[model samples]
Structure formats: structure tokens, C-alpha cells
Target: MAGKTHDFLMVSKSILPEAILKTAKVKELLAQGEVYTIHEAVELVGLSRSAYYKYKDGVFPFYEASRERIITISLLLENKAGVLSHVLNFIASVKGNVLTINQGIPLQGVANVSISIETAGMADTPENLLAGLGEISGVRKIEVIGQT
Candidate 1:
């Protein structure tokens, strides 16, 4: 059923069914750009395309799952030299990996900046990260816009 809910579990790869494991491998091939087409990837991983499609969305390597926890933060920054750089350095000090940064045109001495950061390796929680950003000299305001 379209509205059905599914239960998920974290299981060791050693105990995973061969087809599921192969599905993961196929996905890896595609993600790394080693194979241009699904046909090629599935063949390389010894899986059928149909099976790969079935499990691809459901299966992910544990490290990938952990690494994909990302947060988008919006900042109102003073339009001054090195402000963005300082903000980035602060995030790095907390072990946040910045994924994307978009800064809008300065308006009335302030610029809106949106940054997406991967927090898996961070030493602090998201709230602490926001607090740290807020403490930067040129940052006027900070808010979390999204997370996944």
C-alpha cells in the first residue's frame, strides 16, 4: 500500500543477504562515478537492475548514514572584510564540515548567508554550534533553517 509504513533496523553487513549487499555495492559504484550507467553498475556488483532499484533507497553504508546528518544555518552578517572567513573558521574549530555557502548581496550594510554543514564529526551539538556562530564578531544573528 502507498501509505504503508516500514520498519528499519541497523544490521551488520556480514549477516545481510547477498542481494542486499550487492545492492549496496551497486550504489557505491554509481556514486563514485566508476560506472556511468545503472546497467554497468549492477553488472559490476553482480546484481540485477531491478533488485538494485528495490533496495537502493532503503540501503546505505553506516558511515554514509552517519555522515549525512547536515544542518542549514542562516546568518545575518555585517558587510565587512573577513567576516565570512571568521565564521567558517569558527565552524571548523568545532569540527563542522561545510558543504555549501550562499551569500546574498549586501543590503543596508548586512548580508544574508546560508550555509549547509555536515555535523557528524563535530565535537559539539547543533545548539552549541549555533551559539558559537552567534559569538563571532561580525555575526549579527543566526538561526537553523533546516536539517537532515
Candidate 2:
């Protein structure tokens, strides 16, 4: 593998084949402690073990690739008391180190926020971080805007 050349692309999940998507799910299930073995994870996600093994080394969430780096997340939140606090608290809960935060003035009952976090110390994947943030009451939208 040392002399091999590789290329990569960031693709929308909607356009990916089912086997690839399920392979990712199987990996996630194992990573998140939802399943103890590859066999269990593959069965749970309805992915064949052979397919999982074929793609497992190559298929991973973008966040997994960005581990130990800095990531910026852009979010829109309802303009209300404690909304930003909740967001910050959630980041802290996952051991994410907040490097900078910028919140724009609210418009139409929503405020735009961008937070830069150092993921080296994060206890969870950025994918899970975004998911948890999305579940917060006032968060309108969330996405990873940049990473380094």
C-alpha cells in the first residue's frame, strides 16, 4: 500500500449506494458501543459481513477523518434566552475545546452562530457532536463548515 496513489471525494449521502451507507452504519454501531462485534453490527444494519470487510477500511464519516483537528460548525438557533448557553454546555459535555465563537445578530427570530472547536480532546465524534446539538431545543440547523 505504500506506493499506491489515492483520491477522495465528499459526496452527498443521498447519492451513495445502499451497501456503502450500511457499511458506515455498521462501523458507527460498533464505534458507539451499540454492538460488540462486527457480525452483530453487520446484522443490525442489514449489511453483509463480506461487504463490511470490503469497505470498512475505506469508508468512514468525515468527522473520523478529521479527528485531532480543528473543526468549525455553523448553526442557526432560535433567538431566546439560554440557547447559546445550551450549545456551549453540550460542547463542553463532550470535551470539545472551544477556540472561538461568533454569533451574528438575530434576524427573523434566528441567530447565526459559528463555533471553532479543537477536536483533539473531544470524547465523541464530530458527527455525534452535531447530532446532539441538533437535538437541543433551540437549534434550527447545524453543519460542519470547515476543518483543519
**Candidate achieving the largest TM-score:** 2
Off by over 4 Å in 1: 1-68
Candidate 1 structure quality by residue, lDDT tens digits, 1-148:
7989755565778999999999988888888899999999888878888898888889986546545488788999999999999999989998999999999999999999999999887887666778888988989999767667
Among residues 3 or more apart in sequence or in different chains, the pairs in candidate 2 whose N, CA or C atoms overlap within 3 Å are none
89: Cα error in model 2, Å:
0.7
Off by over 4 Å in 2: 1-9, 18-58
How does model 2 fare in lDDT? Answer: 0.92
Summarize candidate 2's per-residue lDDT along 54-94 as a digit string, tens digits.
99888988888778989899999999999999999999999
CA-RMSD of model 2: 4.2
**TM-scores for every predicted model:** 0.55, 0.68
lDDT values for all models: 0.85, 0.92
Model 1's TM-score against the true structure? 0.55
